[model samples]
Target: MRGWITFAVMSVVTLILLAPIFNIVILSFQGPQTLSGDPVWTVDNFVEIFTQTPVLTYLTNSLLVTLGTTVFGVVIGALAGYPLSRLRNRFARGYSLTLFVVQGLPVIVIVIPLFVVFAAIGLADTLSGVAIIFIAGSMAVTCWMMASYYDSIPYELEEAAWVDGASVFGAFVRIVLRNSYPGILSAAIFSFLVAWNDYLVAVVFLRSESNFTLPIGLQYFFQQNSTDWGPVMAMSVVMLLPPVIIFATLNRYFSIGGIGGAIK
Candidate 1:
């Protein structure tokens, strides 16, 4: 009875969360002229988005930035986390606190300064520039996340590997990381979301139409076609797909491991 009650409550919460997403899917199918009318469904909005807009360019830019952010964020986060997890000293603690402080700082607070620096360095208006910005913005949180996950992992596994003549880095790569798929996936998704949905930094840094990521391009499309709810919502759906696909694909790899069992 208690389990059923818990399931019922969670089902209700799930529906509440999914309501807006379902609305977007519905809106994406409605014809522009009938958005507020009888809800006539058509593929016209999807057709127009492909035929009439540079959506492929926007998609490419978004993929580049998001992929770059996710890859770099995960690698750096995992590498940096090693020291924080294994080292039980003041320096490591101080660095971990620094990461926490950086993570707590709002993006808006640092974006302007970053813009000035990027402008001076001629990184403004480039996809690579936007990707670098995303990497920097997501790095602190990624570090903290990876560190916390590493903290949960017992160090005995690495010590066992060490006794087998494995170097610190090799033991980390082979033992610790093999057990950290869930944490890595979480950080990857977080970085992907940050780069995928970013608008403020993209708007400030990217001026060229060809360099615009999907979020910025979507905003422009909405501003120009404010009354056309169909295509607007279609673009919203497009923006939602990559993260969904990523989570679905990587979720299978998320599980606890028996790294410590290897020792005894």
Candidate 2:
């Protein structure tokens, strides 16, 4: 009875969470309103968005920025984290605390200053500029997450590799990183989401339509008097695909026991 009740509660919660997503997908397939103000079912929304808007260009820009952020975030996070996990010094602890504080800081706070700096440095209105901001915004949290994951890994494994004449960096590459896939993926996912879904930073920094990410490009479906919600939802569905695919493909790699038995 308890188990059945728990399942029922969970099902209700799942439906509540999925209701908005379900609505977006359904609305994306809706066609023009009939004389009676009813929406007819059609694929015209998808076609219109593809044919009329530069959604493909937006998608490409988003992909590039997200890919760059993910790769750099994982690499830099791992590098920074490895030291924080291994070191027991004052500087390392202070740095970790600083990261924690920085992670809590809102992105809206520094965006103006960053815009000024980027504008002066010739990075304004560029996709690369948006990518850099995404990386910077998420890097602190990524480092902390990577460091916490590294703590779970047995340091003795690296010690054994060092005993076999592997240099510190070599041991980290062959042993530590080899077992750190879950952490890497976690950081990559965070960075990808940041770059892919960011509207504020992209809107502030990206001036050219050519450099606009998907989140900013979605505004093209809007007009002065009326909003074309179908294409907007279609673009939203398009925006949803990458993250869904990434999570689905990488779900199997996220295992807590990935490092289990490495010591024994």
Candidate 3:
């Protein structure tokens, strides 16, 4: 009886969470009604978004920025995190605490100053500028997350590798990183989502339509008097696909038990 009740509760919660997504999917397929007042279903929304809009360009820009952010965040996070995890010195502790504090601060606080700096440096109005902001904004949390995961890994594994004449960096690459797939994926996803979904930073920094990310490009679907919700939802669906696909593909790689036998 208890198990059945729990299942029922979870089912209700799942429906509640999925209701908005279900509506978006449904609306993406909906079209203008027939003369007889029946609803018309068609793929015209997706077709129109492709043909009539610059959505493909926006998608390409988003992909480039997101991919760049993910790679940089993972590499930098791994390097910074390994040290923080292995060392128990005062500087390491202080740096970790600094990261924690920086993570708590809002991104808006640095927008103006960053804009000024980027403008002077000729990075303004560029996709690369947006990516730089995404990388910097997400750095603190990425470091913290990678460091926490590294903490869970056994340091003795590295010691064993060292005994085999492997350098510290080499042991990190072979043992720590080889077993750190889950952590790497987590940081990548975070960085990807930040770069992909950011509107404020993109809008503030990007002046040309050619460099606009998907989040900013979606606004073109709206007009002065009315909004074309069909295309809006379709573009939103397009925006949703990359993250969904990434999560689905990477879901199997996220296992906590892989490191259990590494020591023995």
Model 1's alpha-carbon lDDT is 0.88
Write model 1 residue lDDT over 1-264, tens digit each, in one string: 999999999999999999999999999998735545676779989899999998889999999999999999999999998888788999999998898788788889988898899889989889888899888889988888888888887887888889999998898888889888789888999999999989999999999889889989999999999988999899889989888888788887776553545455
Q: Could you tell me how far off, in angstroms, the CA of residue 146 lies in candidate 1 after the best superposition? A: 1.5
Which tens-of-lDDT digit does each residue in 1-264 have in candidate 3? 999999999999999999999999988888887899986898999999899899999999999999999899888888998879899999999998998887887778888889999999999999888888899878887898888899988888999999999998999998898888889889989988888889989888998989888988887555521456787888889999999999999888788534866775
Off by over 4 Å in 3: none
Off by over 4 Å in 1: 32-37, 256-261
**Winning model by TM-score:** 3
TM-score of each: 0.93, 0.94, 0.95
**Model 3 lDDT-worst window of ten:** 219-228
Report, for all candidates in order, the number of backbone clashes: 0, 0, 0
Candidate 1, poorest ten consecutive residues by summed lDDT: 255-264
Worst 10 residues of 2 by lDDT: 219-228
Give per-residue lDDT, candidate 1, residue 22. 98
